[model samples]
Target chain A: MHGDRLLLGPGPSVPYPEALEALTRPVLGHLDPDYLGVISEIGDRLRAVFRTANALTLPVSGTGSAGMEACLVSLLEPGATIIVGVNGYFGERLCEVACRGGAEVVRVEAPWGSPLDPADLLAAQRANPQAALLAVVAAETSTGVRNDVAPLGPELAGTDTLLLVDAVTALGGTPLEVDEWQIDACYSATQKCLGAPPGLAPVTLSPRAVERMRARRTPIQSFYLDLGLLQDYYLASPPTYHHTASSTLAYSLHAGLGRLLAEGLENVWERHARIGAMLQDALPGLGFELIAPERARLPQLTAATLPEGLDEAVLRKRLLTEYGIEVGGGLGAFAGRAWRIGLMGHAATERSVVTLLGAVRQLLG
Target chain B: MHGDRLLLGPGPSVPYPEALEALTRPVLGHLDPDYLGVISEIGDRLRAVFRTANALTLPVSGTGSAGMEACLVSLLEPGATIIVGVNGYFGERLCEVACRGGAEVVRVEAPWGSPLDPADLLAAQRANPQAALLAVVAAETSTGVRNDVAPLGPELAGTDTLLLVDAVTALGGTPLEVDEWQIDACYSATQKCLGAPPGLAPVTLSPRAVERMRARRTPIQSFYLDLGLLQDYYLASPPTYHHTASSTLAYSLHAGLGRLLAEGLENVWERHARIGAMLQDALPGLGFELIAPERARLPQLTAATLPEGLDEAVLRKRLLTEYGIEVGGGLGAFAGRAWRIGLMGHAATERSVVTLLGAVRQLLG
Candidate 1:
């Protein structure tokens, strides 16, 4: 396992030594005064990363998907109208969770490799004026398409409709101005560009979103994800105890975010952008074509449609066995037709890019 | 943060070096052939510890509460009737999750420190044959009551109703005969007897429960927790991908369970029982009163009612601040009236027992 080195998948990229060290640090009670200090720092740090000064910014105990559910379930009560943007697997999942939470869901469809057209969203607003929330993915990991959250948020701003963003693959790798974009509530996963272990989801809730949660006609539909109660515990001045947090994992995530900040968020983003471009440029030499548009592509995740006569899974296996580098195969509809190469967090290193390019090149050759 | 060890109340117990070392092991893709081998081994090991040969068993990538949700949501759909045994916080939580998942929940109530009665459960079943499930906690960590699961499980068996058990604190600390007791489904956390870090819940579904899931009218309430879709990925014969598993944690859990088996399950259970009794016997001299009856006490967790006029929290703080040992303060109505001492999983050592007793005695003096 030693030489296994870093994980270069779209999610749960290899944790740095600091993150791993945090995991090994002595345990702390979730509500201990000393641990509350760490939790307070974490809240401040998440706000900085989330770019939200929203009072309710915090991390949920589950993974990135939990953050998504937290945002959706808390805002949309049973039988509430919500418009969900669907471009890939995760967006489809958002619709499912929203429906399960008892929302009268309406889908605004987009192709996998393309970003959502804002006009379509505006039209949905026109059609469903009673819609209480608009949920969209900022970075669609399944397709490597980064949606333009900046404009969508502002367009939906003046209205009472809250904006929920899934930044699972977008955070740290790119700019997410939660405040500037006017994101009502947005969720991100630690496993992505944070280069930490999975188990925590960083989420931010705007004042408007908080009000909506308070005004819920029915309970959030899931106790594990009820944001009202969770925020009361995570965002209080001294912080209240809600659940026994995975304190060890929380510490590891804090360390990972520390390293992310020390490297400087902008520079980290640039490094991923540069390395992702290198991989993108090199893949064509091996007969692979880009699955997403250049402007819409996420720097941390590059989706490549498999070339004719090549099997996506076999290529992924060959990369792992022959090169000792792990990459992800396509998910959902892209299965066997595409490969997802993640340059996330610590795995965003130039060396990882070179190793992955070498593996794909050799396998195709 | 080196000496930052926490008095983790009841859970997220201080793990051993082996468990921490397992976490730092190299990450593996959840679908990695090597990882699958480890997963299979872990499944078998859990089945052995659970004392059942149930083919469907694996860890869900959430906390103890998620395990509760998985067992309930998978079997009981909206409008279904179920009888829940509530003597503590977690049992009441089960009632809530059941309600959220849309079950018409009825509770068989018991006071804190008192074990749930089998007669009360039998009467509930006779009263409500429409009830599709009976949920109970084998070890109520919140109140320190160990119920008669052996009789309660059989009392609900053979009918259209299923038996669901929550064994988060009981798994490694006591003997659980799933087949012998006819438990339709059971879920437990890793931080307990398995000695793994917090995160990931091991759960098993009996053949009867699986049939119930298969017969569900609507998809299980939550997509992330839909065991039907997840079992495909976990089962070896027809392999599939469910979710991005926490590879590092899985490795850690596998390593921990391996060690648990090597120690021999029965011996481990007996060791905890012996230590618990020894510690309980020493408490009367310290002005602490036994809250749980001797016949129905939990070996892994002991609740001691604080002496009148003695502050339970201050004494707990004294143990942690002065001696660097953590004991749990009371929860719910028991707050300020009791302290919980846990001898569980890897922490069930004679050294832990001796250290805890000594610390308590010193605090009392």
Candidate 2:
């Protein structure tokens, strides 16, 4: 039996009670009318949570990484040119996925724990004029830096280049306007801020992105992740079978998304901001330091500098073992130096912050 | 609110109670040690269930289709040749996935509700001498035909061509000896015979398949479905994160597989055989005809020819809405003429067959 720990880590955060309840409901056949009804409601609620009117909004059958792969592979053909911003681990991951999708990748770099500059993307666009897609991570979970995406739309406005965003950690917790931001494609996970488990990735594509998919010279390398087929399967009336979807996971997402919309997206974002502020303010007094600059700090995921001489792994283990509180160790450049504490969705609460702070104060003093 | 309907579909049959309870457990962090231990134990149990000592045995994070994608994309490179046996929908799906994975497909045909002859595969091999993989569906869920895989091994004994089996509807339902049958790669879904919710796809690869993956000329096109990385992530002691594995789904599978092992594999298979036999013996007396030949018929999935003048869709809807029972409409060539009734895992009980048969009798009379 796994012990119940307070999940403050990067993801798989404490799921909503409704979501958990939904998961235990009886399994439904993939194409069952009742299951399809629940899934359709999920799409509607997901659109409200995403703040987008995009028709292709539906959860991919895999995790967030699968969503990322779907966006890249569907929009890009082999030998297509894609420019990706590499500010943190997820951005670098975008570059890697673009390469794996058989795209010629041009990377524009920013230091870890910092946001990607839209100006640099503009310059990169000038260099790679034939770029088919430009991608970035809106919330870099590894570094807790949130890139400003508003300026990116104007930079690639006239071109046929489609803008893709990884909103895996940003969607429900942060302020994201997919349509207003001119994001051609965006993908996110159910776990991070959706207050659900980590099995489904909700993705939406703009009409422009769908057009690019339609004109692609080659078939999407993955039949499973093909958006055209998925669009037809999810959005089409009397949906045809593409693959067997987990009705259990879909119901969980439905409940989770319902909770998010019920709380109101703005209120959810504000809760994250308040909880994030509590962590940043109080944890520092307990001998921690904020890692990312305030200008680009992510409200949902906070990367904090560990006090000097503290072993990140040992402290995290102690937190888990002693207090039943879980936090994340750093990755890549921040390894051994930082910890990622997520106050995402249901995990973002005043009581949770107080409990965490009290535990931290006790441990430190 | 979804109604609880009896799922007698070809797949996504009734899930086990323990599996449902396991899914409702508190969500664990993706990399939590306790969760990792659960996953490790799941691997051992999956190995035992698959009856293979293959080192690279783990569940793909998506449904069965994702497992098929992972196998084809990881083993075959662009322009490689693959021969697929097309006896049903899934076999045609195998060809589609292979083609999407950039393999040139040579399709060997058999009519619907019929088994593929090994001689056809031999002739296709002679024609496409450069074929890297021979793919086939072990249990044709659409037609309720179970192919004998024992003959395919000898046909490819000395050749470099690897045999891939889609055991989606076969595993845990029938007697499948992976190593003895010389299956180089096999993938199955949790929802079918595994008695778990449909979220994960359990897959195993032979040493030869692993070697082929290692020697791949191009990178796996989709990073999310890359099995080489998943192998390390699942089997390695200090597993690194490839993608966030859903502890909820993993625990559900662990619980489901444990239930299977606890019941004993032989007893489980026998139970299915017994239940399937019961359905086969009684359904015909209610004016239903078995579509597949008795010799090649699948025990778990029974494709029955609908009586003349009985509407397939109307009867299925009545079965669902009126009697709270569900059965599948036929696919491909069998559509409108057949109904596929599945007796799988938890749904393969004597009580289920009795209820279904009684319902059919009442409706037909």
TM-score leader: 2
Residues B1-365, model 2: lDDT tens digits:
56897889987988889888899888898778788889888889998988999999999999999999999999999899999999999999999999888789999988999999888887888787789999989999989998877778777868878889999999999999888888899999999999999989999999999998998878888899999999889888777788989999999999999999999999999999999999999877777899899988888999988888899898989898889898999998888978999999899998999899889888887
For model 1, residues A1-365, the per-residue Cα lDDT tens digits are 44473467677688877988788777666666667777788888888788779988787877787788778877887788999899988889899888877779999999888889878987898788889998888888888898877877778877878888889999988888999988898989888888788888888899988988897667666777778878878767655455667767888889999999889888888988988888888888788888889879888888888889987877777778877777777877788888888898888888887777766667878
For each prediction in turn, the share of the native Cα contacts (below 8 Å between chains A and B) that it retains comes to 0.40, 0.83
Whole-model Cα lDDT of every candidate shown, in order: 0.82, 0.90
Error of 1 at A146 (Å): 1.4
Q: Model 1, range B39-149, lDDT digits (tens) per residue?
A: 898899999988899888998878787788878888988999999999998898899989888789989999978989989987898899889899899999887789888
Clashing pairs in 1: none
Question: Which runs of model 2 end up more than 4 angstroms from their true locations?
Answer: B126-129
Per-residue lDDT for A18-112 in model 2, tens only?
99999988888878888889988888898887778888999999999999999999999889999999988999899888899888999999999
- Distance from true position, residue A143, model 2, in Å? 0.3
Quick one: best DockQ, which candidate?
2
Any residue pairs clashing in model 2, and if so which? none
